[model samples]
Target: MRWAACAAGVGLALVPMTGSAQAQEELEEVQEARRTLLMAMPGTPVSSIWGLVGQLGIGVEHAVGSYVALVGSVQVSGALQGTESLLPGGSGSSGQTWGVGVDPGVHFYLTGRAPEGLWVGPHLELATYHWTVQNEYLMGRPDVPLSEGDLVTVETRSRTVQYGGSVRVGYTAILAPGLTFQVGAGLTALSSRNTNFGTPRVEGGGAATDVEGQQLLGSGFGPNNIRNWSVSPRMTLGVGWAF
Candidate 1:
């Protein structure tokens, strides 16, 4: 009878052990379900080959929910500095400018809760610009007057810094795994300030050098506005990769 009692006690203890094991398994399933609901899709990082308004950009996305994510990107242009100026050929001086911009926003995915499928979002962008132009002239002929060996040359440098914000909406469609195509547009408003400087060499005939005057003479190839603001449209078409 003592042996029988010991076996009964052992069996009784096993009851709670089995119940506890089942409960632990149930808890794990619940936690997994919660994780799946909160993060329907995994987070992905993205980069663009071509950007809106002729820029190159890279970005990342973080999933907060099955249908929502946060996105951010940065863009850069004019990497090839000292490029030929838009000015007419044989301007003696060359011109070049560079710009950088950033974009931040949130995204909503319709098909999945990640950076994939058709997504729409609002973004803000800010950018700045720097430009310079240089020229040398001998005043001998209207055309081809300035030879390669001119003693006196004029150099003009101008810089315009602009800050702008925009409201953007876009749709991203997945082309293949980790690849996407995006097309979007933004309404942008910008405020800008411009500064100019010029240095001219004066020789013979008592020529008066117009320092400030020469600076204000824009060749119509760069930003010539000072303390002005404007509103414009921004558009984008690019291919990107998400991982």
Candidate 2:
């Protein structure tokens, strides 16, 4: 009877120890499964380090599962513009442009893990831009063909709003704990509307002062242009941080 009582005591004592060990193992497993949210910045601020050009943006990534994540970003940028003379001798017609844009995007991670290592994903983006174009003519100039005086002969202006959306496949590599680089290419569909002003306004085939507000590859895309629907190629390269 004493031996049986001692055996019972040993078994009862081990019951609590077995439960404690299982509880510790479960706690460690939970800790290993937990993931941290990551925040990042992409754009000229980050790419400037590599002597590359990039847009400004704030991005975030959250792991929904061990292998999948959700990502999103918001971006704003200024448009580049320049003046070009269309007529003769630098005294003819000239055009100037100004613009600003905003972009927002969402993505789903499909490779490796969220906010770390190598990842490839599909994403969608919406972009909007507001732009202005001004047309000015030189008056009474000897180099110009038909000028009244060396003054403002004619002035016309136009404003445009462009909106676009794109679906892209992107890849990112996290080289270090808080650093990453990305590249993406896609096709975009865009639409634009324009508002014109001034005396000699820009119209098709009959305007003297032509105001053009489109550009591509760092130069003019064409003459006074706003398209209802268009498709174009888009590409991006950037460096960023995940923290």
Q: Which candidate ranks first by lDDT, i.e. highest?
A: 1
RMSD of each: 9.9, 9.7
* After superposition, candidate 2 runs with Cα above 4 Å error: 1-58, 79-100, 117-125, 132-134, 140-148, 153-155, 197-226
Per-model CA lDDT versus the true structure = 0.54, 0.51
Please, what are the lDDT tens digits per residue for candidate 2 over residues 125-168?
45443434443434333455453423233335666666767776
List the lowest-lDDT window of 10 residues for candidate 2: 209-218
Q: By TM-score, how accurate is candidate 1?
A: 0.56
lDDT per residue for candidate 1 within 1-243, as digits (tens), equals 999999999999999999999999986554334311111121111111122224566665666776787876666656222333343433244456566767677777767436545666666666665555444443332343434222334555665566767666666654433455666676877777776645433332123324333433434335445688887776755565544
Give the Å error, residue 77, model 1. Answer: 1.6
Alpha-carbon deviation at 188 in model 2, angstroms: 1.9
| 19 Cα displacement, candidate 1 (Å) | 29
